[model samples]
Target: MNGVVQNDAWREEYNTLKEQYTELKRLKEEVKKLEKSCFTSSQKQLKKLSTIKKQLSKGTSGQEVTAKEVTEVEESLKKIRETLPQPNNLFLRSIVGSINVTIPNSEDKLVYKERYENFKRNVTIVICILSLLAIWIRGYTRLPEFILQFVSAWFYLALTVREQILIRNGSKISTWWVLHHYFSIAIAGIFLIWPEGECYRNFQMQFLYFTLTISGIMYLQFIYQKGQLYKLRTLGRAHQMDFVQDAGMRSRSMGDLYFLVPFLLYTYVFQLANSYRLYNMYYMQECQTLWQVPILGVLFFIVALGNTWTLALVLVRKYNS
Candidate 1:
């Protein structure tokens, strides 16, 4: 009778364990059902996902409509973007639409600041790297010079062309940008006709040194500009999506002038050194290479003045404000 009682107790324990296991499995199934109903567990993300889905279903293109899928998607995205509250930015349209869709342009800045930023970043990197490589490599023909000229021409064309994508997209940078790069093209052009001599060889290394400075400054500028853009983006003060400054933007720009002062001084000092060297090499030393000596001197002076004037103007603007 005692053995029988022990067997019955063991069976009851087994039954309790089985029931508990089944209950756990049932709870898991219920959870899966809830997840299936919601599609996403996070409630915060649901609104955005639902908005997109609704837009696709009932947007510019009718839901059952099979044609113009690209246009439909572009239109839906534009409409959704329009729903967001944005500042009064009428510089350029930042919203780049699909190739097929006619962009619904407002007097807004470029299609997207992010895209323009990426574009400029990529271009700056490629041109600088290739230009540096071209200058470093020794060649019999004007191939290296040609490469440098090609880079200059490409940038100049991109910057100077009327209705270029960047300008149209409302890139409101300084006027000195136009002047500096334009002069760069002219300088590179002079290199094409330059003859090989001791002066030529010496000038090449120095010019490379100067190019290194230019590249370094540009890299630093790119980083600083991106940082500024990030701050504006966080504050939502950016023009459309581009870096359009307002009165509020000056808070950081003014505070940072101290940092820029050093960069400006370095630039002027380097250009002055270059000017002195050119003057000594050409006039004092009696070098007859017009392309490398006198003309270069004149161009270097112009660059220094142009660059200095620009920085001075920026400083005055910041201080006066």
Candidate 2:
């Protein structure tokens, strides 16, 4: 009876051990399946993350990405990381950290710098031509306007070339010099194309229109240059000499004042010329019905005086200042 009892006890113990072993095997299988799924999910998440990182690095604007989309991607990556084994978790963490900083290519920077220099040079040439035209109209017309125009144009062109060389050598062209050059060219062009006589009156009107258009454009440019100068001066006052060293900034300030003087002169001349032509036409046609000759004369005189006074004041101030 005792032996039977002992055998029964052994059997019960073996059954208990068997049950525990079966449970442990089942748990191991489940853990293996979970690990496999985690690995697959992690791989997918890594690939998606890599793609997103590439897009970001390619200069994608923040405006194009939505908060919701970023959150979703981040959440997915987080879930994947949580399931990943310790070794892979470290790798994913490394990838996430590295994605934020981008390495710039020196070659691309060089290319952009070259393109900017080319643009500046072209602007300088246009300015030079405009200067020649202005000077020619101002009183150099006897030397065969075209020849004088050509020589003056070439002279400024040479100056621009020298300025460019100076710039290349690390010295900058003065803004005043550039403005002077461009204003002279523009004035020259206007004078060269000014209309005279009935035969060319219409042409003159057209040219006047063109000059007005150019004046508007130049006015805007002048304003921009002035703003730049103001900022540079402010910076200089702040002890930011680095701003002063910028060729464009230094040139723009002087250019602004230089251009402003000529611009005022050109405006006066344009108004005077247009008014005279209009009066002459009315007189010839006997259609002076609107304005009396005296009134027109007074208006013209006032405008001319005001313009001359303005120019004189400007010069005086410039010299004194």
lDDT of 1 by residue, 1-321 (tens): 455454788899999999999999999889657644443333334455456566666764335544365456555644443433223223213333322121225433354445545555666676677667766675545476656656655655544442234343344555576567667667766765677667777667677667667667766666776677667767876645344222223435677656556766787778777777888888544366464687878888889888788667777877887
C-alpha lDDT of all candidate models, in order: 0.59, 0.49
- Runs off by more than 4 Å, candidate 1: 1-116, 131-145, 162-165, 241-253, 284-286
lDDT of 1: 0.59
Q: Write the per-residue lDDT of candidate 2 for residues 155-205, one digit (tens) a residue.
A: 454444434333322333445455454444444443444333443343243
User: What's model 1's lDDT at 287?
Assistant: 69
Poorly placed runs, candidate 2 (over 4 Å): 1-211, 214-218, 232-256, 292-301
lDDT score of residue 69 within candidate 1: 54
True lDDT of residue 265, candidate 2:
66
Clashes of each: 12, 16
